[model samples]
Target: MAKKMGIVALLLFGVYVLCMYWYIFHSGDGKIPSALQGTAADPVMFMSGKELFLSGEYSKIRNFLFFIATPFEWLIYFLILLMGVSRYFEKITTSQTKWKLLQNAGYLFLLSVFVYIVLFPLNYYRYYLSKSYGISTQTFTSWMKDGVLDFWVSFGMSLIIVTVIYWLMKKSEKRWWLYTWLLTIPFTIFVMFIQPVVIDPLYNDFYPLKNKELETKILSLATQANIPAEHVYEVNMAEKTNALNAYVTGIGSNSRIVLWDTTLNRLTDNEILFIMAHEMGHYVEKHIYFGIAGYLLLTLLGLWLTNKAMRPMIARYGQVLKINKISNIRSYPLFLLLTSILLFASDPVSNYISRYQETRADQYAITLMEDREAAVTAFQKLTISGLSEVNPPLLVKWFRYTHPPMLERIYKVADHEGQKQEIPLKEEQKK
Candidate 1:
């Protein structure tokens, strides 16, 4: 039965990949209004013929990789359980040490190494694809260095979280999920609070915006928006990526408005101001707090569901999977497997919420900056830089998009410009 299920899963995955590839690469260009089109001398198209071809091919492969990553991870965990590898780790750790902490550390280290090795090829391919597409500027050595850092950071955090969860399970098997959920609230906040200050610097150098004049303008804009920001910081991203980006991150005093060097070098002051205004909108609207609240709610439900499901599955397949109980250290893979599946299933809901918030931010930016041309052109440049599909397919939009498609954003802002222009003309006619 399990073998048949695995085969079916593979077949479905293969079919989905082929369908998505055709949909992404073969879909025609999005409709652009006649008014929006430029003259033959200076075209205003989002992507030229060559660019469109490259973007489509790039989008298809990246989407396929993303679609398979989670399921592939789940398969690894499933194999570990089915092959009794996890059970073997548990036995070895027990024989080596009676101390629960040390045993867990040993087992998790081994598991982390195994998983890292298995996933490295997929991860490397993602980087290689970006490099080939002219998006990533990072070399193989620098990329490997970052990858190693990522692995260690991930392992350290996972060890802390898993150790606490197992301890809670042993102490209060029935209510461990609730208690773990409660603990996660503070832990998540702590991570967010310190991320900009403590974690981000490890990856790239950040300094006060070198363009002091632009920094003054940004600060003035922040003041007008009633955002209590002191400075704008710029990160050196020219060495790493060609894509442009800016974001607001952290909480309270640690909060930062950061621009990638690429963004500053590529965009005009007005465009950068529009982008900053959009990021400020996220803060003014308190989207971060709302996002945290939403995440906690979903995780609460996910934990409850995981708890309800784990026990019965263990009872039924204890001997076959060699996981006797939820509290058994060997059952860590089972817990992660269930949670991974839940998170994957919830992507659509989460992505929809993100898109809605992003749309609101866009509206706020347009209202604040009142530069429709800048806003429109900024998005166009961003799309070109990232090689983003202007209008992604429905499934990709629903499952993967965290913001509105580029074509949608461009049209909305361009229409806003037209509406503003019409208002003054109507007033003059009334006179």
Candidate 2:
């Protein structure tokens, strides 16, 4: 049973989860938007034959479309249709440096736009699902604005990397993948260092957590965890969502723990502290830097694999898709599509590493707090508030879940032998 759930969740829900994080690239925000906010019923009402919206029964089917079916559509569209378009575009650009580079940018832009068009339905359905779940609060106009902004950000960043990658391929021919892999390590680190300060603020408002009292408790936890104390932030997501989340983003001086304002409002002080400590565990464990290393390493492997496979794949499908050279601007989509397919195949490996890290953090939180009951209670609240799947099959756990199920967390926290320490948060905040 556990293995079944894990497999289903990994192949199906895992894909959706990947796309879910890809959007905001973090957990959601929640603050009461309009007076109607948080008061509105779920937009997706249960059918007569279905269980209640929050009963966990609806999760299997609802998630089937969001996490599984729709994502496949986009994947196919990119791999098959877009690759065809890319090859067609490549036929026109002459192999001159200035013109070819110029054409590469132009072709890349067209591919992005086309991919966006093909993927929009899935994206909209994602928004619809969030609204249905009563998680999203933004108006349609606002949602569209964010979507556009997200696209432009992706396009601009991808353009820079794709252009450089293809240029290296043009120059090195045989070893371009190695050079590109080398470039991404420093590039990835630079992005991690700057993302919190530069990119996150563009979509949502962030302020120092509003409750000074709770802020003090978080700082104390940080001290216990030996993490920096100054930079806890509250994201203004109340206007856009009711989902509760907190995550550690950025690195070094730029590193900070960001909490959804909704989390602060909805969860108890004990719960919030546990969540923060879990995040602090990441820093204490140096998981972020390690994660970067792991990703760059995988990317290196993926690039090498793609290079090996490209000749045969293009030979088999090239005439059909319309391109000749691997480095052709139009053939770039095939490169991307193939690499993504490779990564998708290996998600289980990546997610397994993530789950271990998250469990370590959970253990850290429980031990540091020395409050087993609070830890269990915190997991319960997190599951209830987020409507998380509590007993996902082992497959899902292996591939889709970054953290263990709430049920597993409860047992782990309960079973661990740790010291008892009295701390603040005996009385809950009024909110």
Candidate 3:
């Protein structure tokens, strides 16, 4: 049964890859609306003809990579269990230590290393693609350094979380899922609280925005939004990538308004202000809190489902998979495999909710800034810098888009400006 399931998983992955390749590469780029095109002096053009082609190709390849990576991750976990690699690691760890904590750590370290090695090729290809497309500026050595740092950080966190989860399972097999879910609420918050101050500094240097004039303007905007930001922070991302970005991160006192140096160097002051306003809108609307709440709810559902599904699967295929029970450390791969499948299944629903929140943030920014021209042009520049598809395929949009498509965003802002202009013209006619 294990062999059959693994084969089926491989076949399904192959079929999906082939279909996605044809769908993404064979399909033509989305056309720009004729009316939306303005001249160089009053430009609304998001991309030139050459840029449109390049962005389309780049976007398609990126979407292909993203769509494949999730299923591939599931397959990796499934194979680890099906092939008894998890059991092998379990045995080695058990032989090495009598303490359960030490054993668990040893097993997880081996698993993490194995998975990293297997996935490194694909990860490197992603970096290579970005470099070839003139997106990534980092050298291979620098990229590898960051990747290693990421792996260690992730492994450390997972070790802690997994140890607690297994401890809960040992305490109460039936109620472990509920207890874990409850624990995750505080754990998730703690991670978010510390992430900005602790984890982020590992990758790049962050400091107060050096342009005091621009920083003052941003702080003023933050004040208007009622965000208690003491300073606008900038990260040195120009050394790594050419992409322009800004975001609001963390909660309460840890919350930070961060801009990539790439963005500051590339965009005008008004454009930067519009982007800052958009990020501020996220806080003003309390989207972060809402996001956290939504995540917890989904996690609760996922954990419950995983518990329900895992028991039956173990009863049927425990012998074949070499996992005797849920509490057994050998079952770790099965647990992760089930959770990953659930997460993959929930991607569309989660992405939809995310897009809605993002749209609301955009609307808030537009209303707060009241500068439609800046908003539209800023989005255009962002699309160019990122080589983003202005209008992606429906499947890609549904599965991957956390924000609205660039074309949709620009059009909305342009239409809002038109309506505002028409209101005054109608008042004059009535007078």
TM-score of 1: 0.91
Sort by TM-score, top down from the best: 3, 1, 2
**Models sorted by lDDT, best on top:** 3, 1, 2
Q: How displaced is residue 51 in candidate 2, in Å?
A: 8.8
Candidate 3 residue-wise lDDT at 175: 93
lDDT to native, each model: 0.84, 0.70, 0.86
Write the number of the candidate with greater TM-score, choosing between 1 and 3.
3
Identify the runs in model 3 with alpha carbons over 4 angstroms from their true place: 27-44, 416-431
Candidate 3's displacement at residue 15, Å, is: 1.7
lDDT of candidate 1 vs native? 0.84
TM-score of each: 0.91, 0.80, 0.93
Tens digits of per-residue lDDT for model 3 on 159-187?
88899989999999999999999999999
Model 3, residue 198: what's the lDDT? Answer: 97
Poorest stretch of ten by lDDT in candidate 1: 420-429
Q: Candidate 1 lDDT, tens digit per residue, 213-233?
A: 999998898999899888899
Best by lDDT: 3
